[model samples]
Target: MAKYHRIIMNGESYYREYRYGSDSYGEMLSEEELVHMLLEEVVDEEIEISEREIESALRRIPDREDRYLLQNYIRCLERVGRE
Candidate 1:
Protein backbone atom coordinates (compact mmCIF):
# COMPACT_ATOMS: atom_id res chain seq x y z
CA MET A 1 0.00 0.00 0.00
CA ALA A 2 0.95 3.62 -0.44
CA LYS A 3 1.01 6.33 2.21
CA TYR A 4 0.25 10.01 2.04
CA HIS A 5 1.53 12.77 4.27
CA ARG A 6 -0.10 16.15 4.65
CA ILE A 7 1.92 19.05 5.94
CA ILE A 8 1.06 22.69 6.52
CA MET A 9 3.69 25.41 6.40
CA ASN A 10 3.42 29.18 6.14
CA GLY A 11 -0.39 28.88 5.89
CA GLU A 12 -0.18 26.53 2.92
CA SER A 13 -0.79 22.79 2.92
CA TYR A 14 1.13 20.24 0.85
CA TYR A 15 0.49 16.56 0.22
CA ARG A 16 3.21 14.03 -0.57
CA GLU A 17 2.45 10.56 -1.80
CA TYR A 18 4.78 7.73 -0.86
CA ARG A 19 4.66 4.45 -2.65
CA TYR A 20 5.66 1.21 -0.97
CA GLY A 21 8.82 -0.26 -2.35
CA SER A 22 11.91 -2.25 -1.41
CA ASP A 23 13.86 -1.28 1.69
CA SER A 24 16.54 0.53 -0.31
CA TYR A 25 14.13 2.46 -2.48
CA GLY A 26 13.76 5.65 -0.51
CA GLU A 27 12.87 7.10 2.83
CA MET A 28 10.07 9.51 3.69
CA LEU A 29 11.12 13.12 3.79
CA SER A 30 10.97 15.03 7.07
CA GLU A 31 8.54 17.86 7.75
CA GLU A 32 11.28 20.46 7.39
CA GLU A 33 12.32 18.92 4.08
CA LEU A 34 8.74 19.02 2.88
CA VAL A 35 8.39 22.67 3.89
CA HIS A 36 11.61 23.56 2.08
CA MET A 37 10.36 21.77 -1.04
CA LEU A 38 7.06 23.61 -0.83
CA LEU A 39 8.79 26.96 -0.44
CA GLU A 40 11.00 26.28 -3.46
CA GLU A 41 7.95 25.34 -5.52
CA VAL A 42 6.19 28.55 -4.48
CA VAL A 43 9.21 30.67 -5.36
CA ASP A 44 9.46 29.02 -8.77
CA GLU A 45 5.77 29.63 -9.40
CA GLU A 46 5.85 33.27 -8.26
CA ILE A 47 8.87 33.81 -10.51
CA GLU A 48 6.69 32.86 -13.46
CA ILE A 49 4.23 35.73 -12.84
CA SER A 50 4.73 38.42 -15.49
CA GLU A 51 7.21 41.16 -14.68
CA ARG A 52 4.74 43.70 -16.09
CA GLU A 53 2.09 42.45 -13.71
CA ILE A 54 4.44 42.88 -10.80
CA GLU A 55 5.48 46.32 -11.91
CA SER A 56 1.84 47.40 -12.39
CA ALA A 57 0.97 46.13 -8.92
CA LEU A 58 3.94 47.89 -7.38
CA ARG A 59 3.02 51.13 -9.08
CA ARG A 60 -0.39 51.01 -7.44
CA ILE A 61 1.09 51.25 -3.95
CA PRO A 62 0.74 54.76 -2.50
CA ASP A 63 2.82 54.29 0.66
CA ARG A 64 6.53 54.75 0.34
CA GLU A 65 7.24 52.06 2.94
CA ASP A 66 5.02 49.56 1.18
CA ARG A 67 6.58 50.37 -2.17
CA TYR A 68 10.08 49.89 -0.78
CA LEU A 69 9.06 46.62 0.80
CA LEU A 70 7.58 45.37 -2.46
CA GLN A 71 10.59 46.48 -4.45
CA ASN A 72 12.89 44.60 -2.10
CA TYR A 73 10.62 41.58 -2.38
CA ILE A 74 10.78 41.68 -6.17
CA ARG A 75 14.55 41.94 -6.03
CA CYS A 76 14.74 38.93 -3.77
CA LEU A 77 12.42 37.01 -6.07
CA GLU A 78 14.55 37.89 -9.06
CA ARG A 79 17.70 36.79 -7.25
CA VAL A 80 16.15 33.50 -6.27
CA GLY A 81 14.79 32.92 -9.76
CA ARG A 82 18.24 33.34 -11.22
CA GLU A 83 19.64 30.51 -9.10
Candidate 2:
Protein backbone atom coordinates (compact mmCIF):
# COMPACT_ATOMS: atom_id res chain seq x y z
CA MET A 1 0.00 0.00 0.00
CA ALA A 2 1.07 3.58 -0.55
CA LYS A 3 2.10 5.25 2.63
CA TYR A 4 0.68 8.60 3.72
CA HIS A 5 1.77 10.69 6.65
CA ARG A 6 0.86 13.85 8.47
CA ILE A 7 3.60 16.42 8.44
CA ILE A 8 1.91 18.88 10.77
CA MET A 9 -1.39 19.96 12.30
CA ASN A 10 -3.41 22.71 14.00
CA GLY A 11 -2.71 25.44 11.44
CA GLU A 12 0.84 24.28 10.86
CA SER A 13 1.92 23.43 7.34
CA TYR A 14 5.54 23.32 6.27
CA TYR A 15 4.87 23.67 2.56
CA ARG A 16 2.35 25.07 0.09
CA GLU A 17 0.87 21.65 -0.71
CA TYR A 18 0.82 17.91 0.01
CA ARG A 19 -0.19 15.00 -2.19
CA TYR A 20 -0.27 11.23 -1.90
CA GLY A 21 -1.84 10.44 -5.26
CA SER A 22 -3.04 12.05 -8.47
CA ASP A 23 -5.05 14.83 -6.86
CA SER A 24 -3.96 17.50 -4.42
CA TYR A 25 -5.27 17.29 -0.85
CA GLY A 26 -5.06 19.24 2.37
CA GLU A 27 -6.53 19.61 5.84
CA MET A 28 -9.71 21.19 7.14
CA LEU A 29 -10.17 24.87 7.89
CA SER A 30 -11.49 26.41 11.06
CA GLU A 31 -14.40 28.83 10.78
CA GLU A 32 -12.00 31.73 11.11
CA GLU A 33 -9.60 30.10 8.68
CA LEU A 34 -12.35 29.69 6.09
CA VAL A 35 -13.34 33.32 6.43
CA HIS A 36 -9.74 34.42 6.17
CA MET A 37 -9.09 32.38 3.02
CA LEU A 38 -12.25 33.64 1.32
CA LEU A 39 -11.28 37.20 2.10
CA GLU A 40 -7.89 36.62 0.57
CA GLU A 41 -9.20 34.97 -2.59
CA VAL A 42 -12.17 37.27 -3.12
CA VAL A 43 -10.31 39.16 -5.85
CA ASP A 44 -10.21 36.13 -8.12
CA GLU A 45 -13.22 34.72 -9.97
CA GLU A 46 -11.43 32.19 -12.12
CA ILE A 47 -10.62 29.53 -9.56
CA GLU A 48 -12.99 26.54 -9.72
CA ILE A 49 -12.95 24.79 -6.40
CA SER A 50 -15.10 22.55 -4.19
CA GLU A 51 -15.61 21.29 -0.64
CA ARG A 52 -12.53 21.77 1.56
CA GLU A 53 -10.79 23.31 -1.40
CA ILE A 54 -8.53 25.39 0.77
CA GLU A 55 -5.05 25.16 -0.72
CA SER A 56 -6.06 25.75 -4.35
CA ALA A 57 -7.78 28.97 -3.41
CA LEU A 58 -4.81 29.88 -1.27
CA ARG A 59 -2.29 29.55 -4.10
CA ARG A 60 -3.97 32.49 -5.83
CA ILE A 61 -3.41 34.70 -2.82
CA PRO A 62 -0.27 36.78 -3.35
CA ASP A 63 0.05 37.71 0.28
CA ARG A 64 2.35 35.34 2.16
CA GLU A 65 0.53 35.97 5.41
CA ASP A 66 -2.76 34.76 3.99
CA ARG A 67 -1.09 31.79 2.37
CA TYR A 68 0.70 30.87 5.55
CA LEU A 69 -2.45 31.06 7.63
CA LEU A 70 -4.42 28.96 5.15
CA GLN A 71 -1.57 26.50 4.81
CA ASN A 72 -1.72 25.86 8.52
CA TYR A 73 -5.42 25.17 8.29
CA ILE A 74 -4.73 22.71 5.47
CA ARG A 75 -2.21 20.89 7.58
CA CYS A 76 -4.71 20.54 10.37
CA LEU A 77 -7.53 19.42 8.11
CA GLU A 78 -5.54 16.98 6.02
CA ARG A 79 -3.96 15.46 9.06
CA VAL A 80 -7.36 14.46 10.40
CA GLY A 81 -8.30 12.64 7.23
CA ARG A 82 -5.02 10.75 7.05
CA GLU A 83 -5.06 9.85 10.72
Candidate 3:
Protein backbone atom coordinates (compact mmCIF):
# COMPACT_ATOMS: atom_id res chain seq x y z
CA MET A 1 0.00 0.00 0.00
CA ALA A 2 1.09 3.56 -0.66
CA LYS A 3 1.14 6.31 1.91
CA TYR A 4 0.18 9.94 1.64
CA HIS A 5 0.76 13.20 3.52
CA ARG A 6 -1.07 16.50 3.64
CA ILE A 7 0.73 19.61 2.53
CA ILE A 8 -0.25 23.17 1.71
CA MET A 9 0.18 25.07 -1.52
CA ASN A 10 -0.84 28.58 -2.58
CA GLY A 11 -2.93 28.94 0.62
CA GLU A 12 -4.88 25.76 -0.21
CA SER A 13 -4.44 22.17 1.01
CA TYR A 14 -3.73 18.94 -0.83
CA TYR A 15 -2.98 15.31 -0.06
CA ARG A 16 0.27 14.15 -1.59
CA GLU A 17 2.07 10.83 -1.68
CA TYR A 18 5.51 11.47 -0.30
CA ARG A 19 6.94 8.34 -1.89
CA TYR A 20 5.32 8.37 -5.26
CA GLY A 21 8.67 7.96 -6.89
CA SER A 22 10.03 5.17 -4.76
CA ASP A 23 10.39 2.85 -7.75
CA SER A 24 13.05 5.30 -8.85
CA TYR A 25 15.60 5.02 -6.08
CA GLY A 26 13.22 6.06 -3.27
CA GLU A 27 12.33 9.26 -4.96
CA MET A 28 9.22 10.96 -3.59
CA LEU A 29 6.44 13.38 -4.45
CA SER A 30 7.95 16.34 -2.66
CA GLU A 31 9.93 18.45 -5.09
CA GLU A 32 10.65 20.56 -2.09
CA GLU A 33 12.39 17.64 -0.49
CA LEU A 34 14.73 17.24 -3.41
CA VAL A 35 15.36 20.95 -3.67
CA HIS A 36 15.77 21.20 0.05
CA MET A 37 18.40 18.49 -0.03
CA LEU A 38 20.21 20.35 -2.75
CA LEU A 39 20.07 23.55 -0.79
CA GLU A 40 21.29 21.69 2.23
CA GLU A 41 24.34 20.65 0.30
CA VAL A 42 24.73 24.19 -0.95
CA VAL A 43 24.70 25.43 2.61
CA ASP A 44 27.78 23.31 3.26
CA GLU A 45 29.49 24.35 0.07
CA GLU A 46 31.03 27.54 -1.22
CA ILE A 47 27.89 28.36 -3.19
CA GLU A 48 26.15 31.61 -2.45
CA ILE A 49 22.38 31.66 -2.27
CA SER A 50 20.35 34.67 -1.29
CA GLU A 51 18.32 34.54 1.92
CA ARG A 52 15.20 35.55 0.00
CA GLU A 53 15.57 32.52 -2.23
CA ILE A 54 15.89 30.22 0.74
CA GLU A 55 12.92 31.76 2.53
CA SER A 56 10.83 31.67 -0.63
CA ALA A 57 11.49 27.96 -0.91
CA LEU A 58 10.83 27.50 2.78
CA ARG A 59 7.36 29.04 2.51
CA ARG A 60 6.43 26.44 -0.10
CA ILE A 61 7.01 23.60 2.32
CA PRO A 62 4.44 22.61 4.95
CA ASP A 63 5.36 21.90 8.53
CA ARG A 64 7.15 18.54 8.63
CA GLU A 65 10.40 17.04 9.85
CA ASP A 66 12.33 18.04 6.75
CA ARG A 67 10.83 21.50 6.85
CA TYR A 68 11.82 21.88 10.45
CA LEU A 69 15.30 20.67 9.63
CA LEU A 70 15.65 23.29 6.95
CA GLN A 71 14.14 25.90 9.23
CA ASN A 72 16.62 25.12 11.95
CA TYR A 73 19.38 25.32 9.38
CA ILE A 74 18.36 28.82 8.43
CA ARG A 75 17.91 29.70 12.07
CA CYS A 76 21.52 28.68 12.66
CA LEU A 77 22.49 30.99 9.87
CA GLU A 78 20.51 33.77 11.49
CA ARG A 79 22.14 33.08 14.83
CA VAL A 80 25.47 33.49 13.10
CA GLY A 81 24.25 36.79 11.60
CA ARG A 82 23.59 35.86 7.98
CA GLU A 83 22.12 39.22 7.06
Candidate 4:
Protein backbone atom coordinates (compact mmCIF):
# COMPACT_ATOMS: atom_id res chain seq x y z
CA MET A 1 0.00 0.00 0.00
CA ALA A 2 1.03 3.64 -0.55
CA LYS A 3 0.90 6.40 2.04
CA TYR A 4 0.96 10.19 1.77
CA HIS A 5 3.06 11.89 4.42
CA ARG A 6 2.88 15.64 5.01
CA ILE A 7 5.83 17.40 6.56
CA ILE A 8 5.97 21.00 7.71
CA MET A 9 9.44 22.48 7.85
CA ASN A 10 10.39 26.14 8.33
CA GLY A 11 6.71 27.06 7.97
CA GLU A 12 6.43 25.41 4.53
CA SER A 13 4.36 22.27 3.96
CA TYR A 14 5.71 19.50 1.77
CA TYR A 15 4.26 16.11 0.93
CA ARG A 16 6.03 12.88 0.16
CA GLU A 17 4.59 9.69 -1.25
CA TYR A 18 5.78 6.52 0.46
CA ARG A 19 5.32 3.01 -0.85
CA TYR A 20 5.21 0.66 2.14
CA GLY A 21 7.58 -2.16 1.21
CA SER A 22 9.84 -0.07 -1.03
CA ASP A 23 10.46 2.77 1.44
CA SER A 24 10.19 0.81 4.68
CA TYR A 25 13.88 1.07 5.52
CA GLY A 26 14.39 4.62 4.23
CA GLU A 27 14.47 7.73 6.41
CA MET A 28 12.34 10.75 5.51
CA LEU A 29 14.18 13.50 3.67
CA SER A 30 14.04 17.26 4.09
CA GLU A 31 12.64 19.29 1.14
CA GLU A 32 16.05 20.35 -0.13
CA GLU A 33 17.42 16.83 0.19
CA LEU A 34 14.48 15.41 -1.73
CA VAL A 35 14.93 18.01 -4.50
CA HIS A 36 18.60 17.14 -4.80
CA MET A 37 17.84 13.42 -4.98
CA LEU A 38 15.29 14.03 -7.77
CA LEU A 39 17.74 16.15 -9.73
CA GLU A 40 20.45 13.50 -9.46
CA GLU A 41 18.16 10.98 -11.17
CA VAL A 42 18.06 13.03 -14.38
CA VAL A 43 20.35 11.79 -17.19
CA ASP A 44 22.13 14.24 -19.48
CA GLU A 45 23.20 13.26 -22.99
CA GLU A 46 24.94 15.00 -25.89
CA ILE A 47 23.86 14.51 -29.53
CA GLU A 48 25.84 15.53 -32.58
CA ILE A 49 24.27 16.53 -35.91
CA SER A 50 25.95 17.16 -39.25
CA GLU A 51 25.82 20.62 -40.87
CA ARG A 52 24.28 19.08 -44.03
CA GLU A 53 21.55 17.44 -41.94
CA ILE A 54 20.85 20.75 -40.20
CA GLU A 55 20.52 22.60 -43.51
CA SER A 56 18.26 19.86 -44.89
CA ALA A 57 15.97 20.09 -41.88
CA LEU A 58 15.83 23.89 -42.07
CA ARG A 59 14.96 23.64 -45.77
CA ARG A 60 11.83 21.66 -44.87
CA ILE A 61 10.37 24.67 -42.98
CA PRO A 62 8.25 25.54 -46.11
CA ASP A 63 8.41 29.39 -46.22
CA ARG A 64 10.37 32.47 -45.19
CA GLU A 65 7.28 33.81 -43.32
CA ASP A 66 7.12 30.75 -41.10
CA ARG A 67 10.88 30.90 -40.49
CA TYR A 68 10.69 34.59 -39.58
CA LEU A 69 7.80 33.87 -37.17
CA LEU A 70 9.82 31.17 -35.46
CA GLN A 71 12.83 33.45 -35.18
CA ASN A 72 10.68 36.21 -33.64
CA TYR A 73 9.24 33.73 -31.12
CA ILE A 74 12.76 32.62 -30.13
CA ARG A 75 13.85 36.26 -29.70
CA CYS A 76 10.84 36.99 -27.46
CA LEU A 77 11.67 33.96 -25.28
CA GLU A 78 15.28 35.14 -24.97
CA ARG A 79 14.08 38.53 -23.73
CA VAL A 80 11.67 37.06 -21.16
CA GLY A 81 12.26 33.87 -19.25
CA ARG A 82 9.43 31.35 -19.13
CA GLU A 83 6.89 32.19 -16.40
CA RMSD of all predictions: 12.1, 20.5, 18.6, 6.4
Q: Which predicted model would earn the best lDDT?
A: 1
TM-score of each: 0.42, 0.32, 0.32, 0.43
Runs of candidate 1 exceeding 4 Å displacement: 1-48
lDDT of 1 by residue, 1-83 (tens): 34556666777665566555633333456667766765776664443578799889899999989999989988998899899
Q: Which pairs clash (backbone N, Cα, C closer than 3 Å) in model 3?
A: none
Worst window of 10 by summed lDDT in candidate 2: 1-10
Residues 2-76 of candidate 3 have per-residue lDDT tens digits of: 455656688655455556566322334455664566567557657687979988898889877878899998788
lDDT of 1 at 55: 88
Worst 10 residues of 3 by lDDT: 23-32
- Can you write out model 2's per-residue Cα lDDT over 1-83, one digit (the tens) per residue? 22233344666643223475666656654555655665676665566647556556788899999899888887898799898
By descending TM-score, how would the candidates be arranged?
4, 1, 3, 2
lDDT of each: 0.71, 0.62, 0.67, 0.68
Off by over 4 Å in 4: 1-4, 9-17, 22-25, 43-67, 76-80
Tell me the lDDT of model 1 at 49. Answer: 71
